[model samples]
Target: MRRFFAIGLLAIHLFNIAGYSLVFQYFIYQTDTNLITKLDLNQYRESELIQFKIPISVPYIADRPDYERVDGQVEIKGVLYTYVKRKIERDTIYLQCLPNRVTQRLSKARNAYTKHVNDLPQSKKNQTGSTIKKSGIFSEYDFKTLDYQFAAPLATASTYISYLSPSPVPGALEVPGKPPENRG
Candidate 1:
């Protein structure tokens, strides 16, 4: 008798569980489903969009440095270089010339072009002008130059963002002295 009673109770529990499962499934099947619709692209217009502008003068980093161009005349080390009309005189005699040696005169493009003048007293960076002073069989010339350095400004990048977050629940953990993104 005890065995039969225990079996009857187990059957009742199984029946209840099966009936509850069927009811849950029926409720789930009877619920309404969300409808799928195609999006209407025409609703959004190009003019309604927000415009963000970045006004940085330098677009990208420069691989080669830039130098400040000194206009007019640059002066250094007690010498000044200025653009001026320069005249040079050339009158020479090769005392001991080799049979295979040759001499090239200055180009007439910048030449004084006068019968009495030969050396054009021009201030060029790397030019070694004719003898400033000649003594007997030796001569000495002068060169003008200035040491310049290249420089460029370093690029700087700064970024900022505005974020909006819904207000936190009435009672939530928050950082000290800091408010949520959207306060207004």
Candidate 2:
């Protein structure tokens, strides 16, 4: 009777463990599926944006102003030259890709870095600029993994301009300005 009772208890424990293991495995699978689904949704949004070009604004430093003062008489001050100064211009935003899971991660990281930079009271966000010059997708065979490469034009000075600007301005540039003159 004692031997039978011990064996029965062991059997019950084993069965319970097996059930828990199965449940845990199911839960993990579900979680992984959900993650993949979310990634897919992000990918879809990125694809949609690829069909249309978005504008990205970047800031650049302009030329600094200088002033000069001259004296006509040895004893009295004569003239003062005042310089005309202009503030830095705001950058144009060119959206290369929409916020997808992968790019979203990149964007978040960038935002965090920007925030940290801004926290430095001395740092200026308006003086910074960035431009996405080229981008493309590449896929790996084994996992069918797709990735993108973005090249941006950045300037430390607020007066700088993008090396390459996207052709056809977002909405304004669409209208034709003037027809080319006929050449004989």
Candidate 3:
């Protein structure tokens, strides 16, 4: 009788552990973030980069998001220069594609980088200004990944890996000439 009781308890514990593991996996997700900053950017009054990580995390049981968005504002000398967001819809989103503006901007940066590198030796150019935003999906036979980037000249950047279930925040978009929020 005692042997049977021990085996029953062991079976129950195994089932409980497996149940907890599956529940944990259901709630977990990944947000792969990367930010690139320039080392000497502060020396240039006309240039600055500011970033924010907005929270969109929620429990899967409560709500699941089909669209994920990141919104942030860039301020230079306490003045808002631009507001940017990366909003992707799952059903309509192609696995790996750059947004129109991001593609154009990165292409422009590459062109500028090539020009500046060539011009520096021939002329007296001491500095080259470059910036880019690029994001896309990377796919292989085994897996697909979401990735993004921010770039500036003269330094390598930092990347952050997070597991945050996401949702979009309404009214997060800002346009040029619109009244700015008080960031003070």
Candidate 4:
């Protein structure tokens, strides 16, 4: 009877440790890293829907949106990530993300174009008596029309979720109330 009781206690302790480890890993991945989940397109088919739990810090957790296709972006560590909010269950947010490279490239190009356009007038001022240049061939409205015509036929972009490891610094759990803890 004594040996059986000792074995039962050990089993209970081991199960407790296993449960705590699972919860700790889940918390670390959700809050400390940019990873949506451990699962990715490589592990499943492109058409299959992958659901993951999100931290409560995410917006619209209480007031769920009526539309299924809500788009949102979050900036983590100065990098912007674009994702579509497909469904929401309490704090869990199910969504698909756009590749970081594509979004980053588009953002950079937009900034460069804006800078170039802003400087165009200054450069024109320096050139005296130069022949007047014609306006761009396509007007703003023309581009909108073109987009409407081609938007549906274009293929939807597929993306693979990328992961970023947590920083080496100690988190709040490791050092409570410490000034050196990284809040970002």
- Considering every candidate listed, which one attains the maximal lDDT? 4
| Candidate 3 TM-score, true structure as reference | 0.15
TM-score of 4: 0.25
Candidate ranking (lDDT, best to worst): 4, 2, 3, 1
- Which candidate model has the greater TM-score, 1 or 4? 4
Q: Candidate 3 — which residues are off by over 4 angstroms?
A: 1-68, 71-98, 109-116, 119-184
- What is the lDDT for 64 in model 2? 26
Assess candidate 1 and give its TM-score to the true structure: 0.13
- TM-score-sorted candidate list, best first: 4, 2, 3, 1
lDDT of 2 at 35: 44
Candidate 4 residues lying further than 4 Å off, grouped into runs, are 1-52, 57-67, 109-184
Residue range 81-121, candidate 3, lDDT tens digits:
23322333332221211122332344444445444533433
TM-scores of the candidates are 0.13, 0.18, 0.15, 0.25
Query: Which candidate number would show the highest TM-score if scored against the true structure?
Result: 4
* Residue pairs in clash, model 3: none
In the range 1-184, model 2's lDDT, one tens digit per residue, is 9999999999888655454444544654554455445544543343333221223354454422332221111111322111111122233211222222432343334445445533533234344454222121332233666899997877564785556557655334565678889999
